[model samples]
Target: MKDDSTEISARRRYFRYAVFSLTALLVMSLGMAIVPRQPPAPAETPFSERARAAALADALALRAAGQELAGAAAGDGGPGTDTALDRTVTLLTIQARALVLPGDTPTASAGTGPGHRTAQASSAGVPASPGNSATPGPASLSELATDLAASGATRLTDALEADGGMARLLAGAGAAQLLAAGEIAALAGVPAAELPGWQEPAGPSAQPSPARGCTSAGPSGGADGERVDPGTGAGLGAALTATLDAEHQAVYGYQAALTRLDPTAATQASSLLAEHLDLADEAETYAALQCTAIPPTPPGYVLDPAFLGAPAAGLARLESATLTAFGDVVALSAAPARGWAVSALVAAARRTANWGVDPGPVPGLTLDESQLPALPDRPENAALTASPAAT
Candidate 1:
């Protein structure tokens, strides 16, 4: 009887222990249910990265707007309008393709032109026109002009925050947009002064240090003096010197061309010549700030006999060549030097146009249009061709 009683006590102890464990587990689960768990916070995007994405998005939108305008022009406007819109579209396409992220593969499709995503109707304070719709309607020329100017202004603002290579591209793109804006405005009979003007942004007071392995002293000396090698790693100093060299050539070209030009053309040439002289002085000041050796200007530059024969065409070619030098300055220097370079680029491009030559899509960038990345496939843009403005 005592053995049976002890066995019952053991069973009772085991039952109590099981009950205690179950109660504790229930209490803990209830406690857990009452407390809220927090989720992990998202990582912050860097400003430079954000700027790049914004630029890409803007490029896409501008391209779409250009396409819309082209279509409208085709239906109602004259051939001149069609031509201008086509060129503008081409420029926007190149910019959009260039702005694509390094590793993000664009959608592949046969004969795909500049891809159009369903982006915001307006970006960077630019108002959306009727053309931004999914089923876009015809837009007025005046509205298109306003959009281009605002878009260009936004690009310049973004350029201030982008990396070196991107900054250069953005500056060029911005200048192109502004140029197109003026052209479109002219077509619409809008006053050029009414459009947005290029304003230099505030930036680092001091220039960034030269690239690693670069020295103030250049690789080789010319007959004039120790010429700064404008090669890679030569930094802003070399770039400025190179630009000064180009300016020197431009100055000489204008002087030579002035003699051959008609009286009216000569008057304009003389004004431009004075401007070139001022530009040369400005380039020298920047070079001196960098401690780069400035070479003496040659007494004369070699001019093509054909160039001498047709001074106007030659002047256009000369102005176009200066664009590369200015672009290098845009890439290598920070503001306000970069701002200066951008202005120079715009002026040169306009001058090229003034001389009756089209600056092609991109003025500063020498691109092989054939090798540029094909536009990515977007379901929304299935109906768009690779060149919406083509013939």
Candidate 2:
């Protein structure tokens, strides 16, 4: 009887142990089943990378439109259309090269001939406008003009989001696109009213006051205008000061040019002169706001003797020269300032065009065409070559 009792007690102990083990395992399994697993987070793209991709995408689309325009021009588009198309193509190609980052290879749709490829909407969330859809053949000149204008508008929007250097680049490219579009539209018989107008971005409520201890000297007469000291630092202040000085010089140049220009030309010069004076005042206000010391404007500026012989040409040269300063302002400033700078850039470029000089591919940023990245090795890009002016 004693041996039987011991065996029963040991069996009961073993049964309890097995039940505890099973319960523990079941609880662990339930816990695991009840909990959910989280997915790994995606890495965020950098602004620079995103900007470059967007710019390149826009450039490619512009180039495709340019190619279509080129074909149309070749086939009786209109007089001067060939020249306009050449410039348009050149601008698109240079902008594409500028947007290419180191180690990046731009790819286009394969098997499409020049003017045959459809423009892809920018991956930067820009939606395609009407008539931008892929077609069986080349797009009409009007359609191409619309695409260029749309792309230009997209670039301007992207500029607002880009860093300083990139903002300047995009602004210039955007201006180029608009200019090219206008030219092509004229050739295509599209009404000027039909082109989309670029709306300036909203500016700050009020210009900031100048810092303490900052002051300005009145205008002084000198053969060469007094150079404003671009403050100790390189920034918006410096850019504004430089632009102010450029405007002063421009005011002087326009005045001198007006003396030699024909009545018709003088009227335009006089109007532009007033605009330059206004710009000078605007720049001065901006500089003071930044606490930059304003130097006295020189009464006279050194002019090229050639300017006397060809005042109109000289004015174009003068206008072209001011672009860099305006571009600097665009790069260094925020809203209102940048908006002003962009308007200045576009106006200057248009003025240059009026004087019969083609503002090269990128207006503000001076680039060595030889150093720019070559177009990707693709069959469709064969006809897209940089123009002489681009160089």
Candidate 3:
């Protein structure tokens, strides 16, 4: 079973303070609710009426939120949110202490000029505003924390709002921030090890290459569904060899089609074929780091240029040939090794189609996304060139 390692890891800091750190976040999140809001300035000219309404609303919201939090497990707080021990106590402490301050609102929201000074100095039935929105009055800070721990936040939105109104409480609330960071850190773990970010850590740039032991391409070489033989070498080298073979065949088929197509289409196919060649060369060089005996064969598969007739007919045959060759290579690969070759073939076939040459005239097999490059999260700029037929 997949453990909450990810979640727990995210709340590492909170976990550091107390084992029940996550519990705190969960409990507080459960109780979040919207307290009654202050009345609009137009509706209540007397600030006292608006303030009373706000307090009343806040109380109801707090009560409702508290009930919710009570039933939820700490699991509900999410990774790193360690709402229970860290956020809950911190927020509550702020609010509890804040309730003692005298102000128009939390953090000292007060009218400036002569009025505020008079209100502060005299306190003769006048409301003293907050010094800053970021610094809620002591009473507001305490109440706000109390409200959040009780029931005010449900989604991330609520949490943000609660934070906004509880400045004094948030002053020393670095713990909540840690919880969020912890969750993010946990998620970043696996991928970080496998695929380094732009700033990669430099270690020993050298590694011993695996020996190439196998002799022939295994019997599995057939269609898109074929697997590799256990007879071959492991990992990057085996994958590179397989891909290189496929690239060679694809290049050959593309050249065969070029002789039969219009000048424009032929030129395009030639360019794509060159790209495959370049990719193959790169794969071979990189692959040298893994295995020794990568069989580089001289160009053999091709039709006589004189036999090339109708552009359409030539393309149709070439596509069919390339597709079948792809299947054959795949059949020769082992299960783990098939993924790389499959990807190369699929990408080549798609680019071939961009030349407007459909091998379907000869029953070409369908290649799938599983055999191509990783799909973008959102393919906003997806474009397929007009096929030869379409043109």
Candidate 4:
């Protein structure tokens, strides 16, 4: 009987140990089931990458635009003679280049009041003023362009608008004033509507003139004075007004694209459409200031049927064409306006690329030799690099 009791006790102890082990195992299993699995490591943000590329591209473009403006200013034998505009251009150029070039410093002042400025040239030969060092990258380039554009717009606009300032600038009748006016306004982010007044009244015509320099003759006059050149004073303004008309047409194109784009693409298409509207409005503002009868937008644009079938491709083609148009005007424009046109070109190029189009080596300008097979033989091609007449 004692042995039986012992056996019962031993069996009971074994059962309790087995139950405890089973309970512990079950609890562990339940805990694991309730715990959440970790999500995959977050992917790199698409915006960040795009921002970097855009910044770099803008910096490069701004630098190029600046150089062109400075050169034009210098050619006028006014503010550019002292390299005031050139110095400013150089400073901005260095800052832009530094953003893309590794081991280069971005610390540079935009220069102090007017042309009397001091700065050292970067290794790339662009002037750079001393300032806080910048982290050389896309973000830095974008930030620089944004900050400079904002500050420039405010100060320059105020200077031009205040107490006969515009009148005084225009009265100077210097090439610096004519060419730099649009560029300065562009840099300041001034709207086209706010463009400064012209001291003289003039108009533009599409025909080419024989004169090497600008002629004050009527739009159809045969004299060189009738030709459209920066020296003529009237052509640049006319070209700008015409550009505004082109921008107006661009808005229509975007609107058409929005109708055919996919839901996913429509979101981007809408944003692009809005941008075109703003550009159109700005263009009109400038055109109105010229006192020219701004060309009204046509009731409808003839969009390609292929674009209606494939909205993306159509939009891309439209962007490319606009970029080319802007480039055509750039060749004819003087300082400030020329720079502004370049910015438009860059923006169009970016949009074109977004639509899966290759913008080519030069986004806006067709400087490619292979593309211009007959360009070399044309006597007019020599003037292609020269300042263009208002078309």
The lDDT for every candidate, in the order shown, is 0.68, 0.71, 0.35, 0.44
- Give the Cα error of residue 230 in candidate 4, in Å: 11
lDDT of 3 by residue, 311-377 (tens): 4445444444545443333444332233333433444444544444433211113334233332112
lDDT of 2 by residue, 1-391 (tens): 9999999999999999999999999999999889987778988766645656656765765677667658755857555877778778878888889877666654454433333323444334442322223333565777667667766666666666667788778878878888888888888899866865566666556655555344443212221232332432466767888899888888888888887988998998899999999889888877765666778878788887898899888888888988998888877777667788887888888888889888877788888888987766433432221111111
Which structure is stronger by TM-score: 3 or 4? 4
Please, what is the TM-score per model? 0.73, 0.77, 0.28, 0.39
- Mind giving the per-residue lDDT tens digits that candidate 4 earns over 238-286? 6666567667667777887777778989999899988888767655544
RMSD of 1: 8.6
lDDT of 1 by residue, 1-391 (tens): 9999999999999999999999999999999999988878989766556555555555665676678778756857787788888887787788777766656433323422332222233333332211223443434677567666666665666665566666667777777888888888888899998875656644345543323233444323212343222446557777888889888988999999888899999999999999899889878766765656778788888888899889999999988888888878877776577777877887888888889987766677777777777666444332221111111
Top-scoring candidate (lDDT) = 2
Give lDDT for model 1: 0.68
Better of 3 and 4 by lDDT: 4
Q: Considering summed lDDT, which 10 consecutive residues are worst modelled in model 3?
A: 113-122
Q: Where does candidate 1 stray beyond 4 Å?
A: 1-41, 102-136, 201-231, 378-391
Which is the better candidate, 1 or 4, if ranked by lDDT?
1
Return the clash pairs for model 2, or none.
none
